[model samples]
Target: MSDNPAADAVLNLVKQQHDVLEKMLNNVSQAGEAQRKAAMGSLERFLSAHEAAEEAYLEQATKNLENMQGWVEKLTELDYTSSDFVTRFGEFQKELINHTQTEIQHTIPKALRDMTQAQIDLVQSAFERVSETAEPVE
Candidate 1:
């Protein structure tokens, strides 16, 4: 939606983050007891870092942080093996994916509409700064 190529590039980066998050969620969901904790930690760290990048660069795209955090908290309290956990985690994944898509499709573009070139560059710079540090170790 943004006319600026820089904004478009940032949107692409954001989409890549969503792709990574989706993979991480799948990893956590499929992880065995021996690996679930570490997998979840990596997912949580990436989620936190992704949110931080958005908050720092594009506040309008992060309106659901509190809601997402609530889901994270609820999931943390239940056993991963429980049926309820699976059900709720599925719902959480759906919501998070929806939120990310919305940001990519509408929110970030709308925010970029009002910004100058310099501001857009700043957003790109700031987002990369936070996001690069949160990349998971393979």
Candidate 2:
């Protein structure tokens, strides 16, 4: 479930980080200053990692797909919850679900489906090769 073949390994890594990210963001909303600070560190790391991955993704994806990047930027900017861990995790989960739906139902498939077999092969080979060096997101 964590390893995504359609995306470059970087984005797959980010997607795999989702559960941890959700928990951290939720913690920040519920905990005191000390706990919040710890959660912030986790959030910062997730943000840094996801941002770096997204920037790399721009190179692999078609220009049209950069809009997906913009959406992710907005998503990462959102406060997962305002009052409590439950609410925050809920929000984060909802956003992740929505974004995942879009990626699977439209974005990634659209990019590949429009390609010729040779082009698909090229992209698939590149993904497999890159995946060899990257950690499994799941």
Candidate 3:
């Protein structure tokens, strides 16, 4: 946690989001075919919102997560029950883990150190707003 209270708050929020995304990813991995689609959908929607908020408020402070848009598109194309989908999804999971770990270990703290309290507060507000009001991806 940063010495700045606002930065600390933003860090906490981002960490919580990371935990939620990890849980969602696990749900997708463990889900049966009948349930995989819903789990994946939830993950994708939340990811979209999270990325949008980061782009709007945090991109300048941290290296944005590697774009996983292509992975999402590919996943959408493959039948969830197929072995190909399983392989690809596993790959996506690995990348997600790496990206989140990088943020937690490096990018987030570095960003917070550089930001003023007002900027940190803006990031926190945007994250909360986007999380609450983000529309579901079609």
| TM-scores for candidates 1 onward, in order | 0.88, 0.43, 0.87
Cα lDDT listed for each candidate: 0.80, 0.48, 0.79
1 versus 3: better lDDT goes to = 1
Worst 10 residues of 3 by lDDT: 58-67
Model 3, residue 120: C-alpha shift (Å): 1.0
State candidate 1's TM-score.
0.88
Rank list by lDDT = 1, 3, 2
Residue pairs with colliding backbones in model 2 are 2-138
lDDT of 1 by residue, 1-138 (tens): 456799887787778788888998888778776787778778888888888777776777667677888898998898876778778888998998898888888888888888888988988886676568766644
Off by over 4 Å in 1: none
Which one is best on lDDT?
Answer: 1
Candidate 2 structure lDDT: 0.48
Candidate 2 weakest ten by summed lDDT: 129-138
Better of 1 and 3 by TM-score: 1
Candidate 3, lDDT over the whole model: 0.79
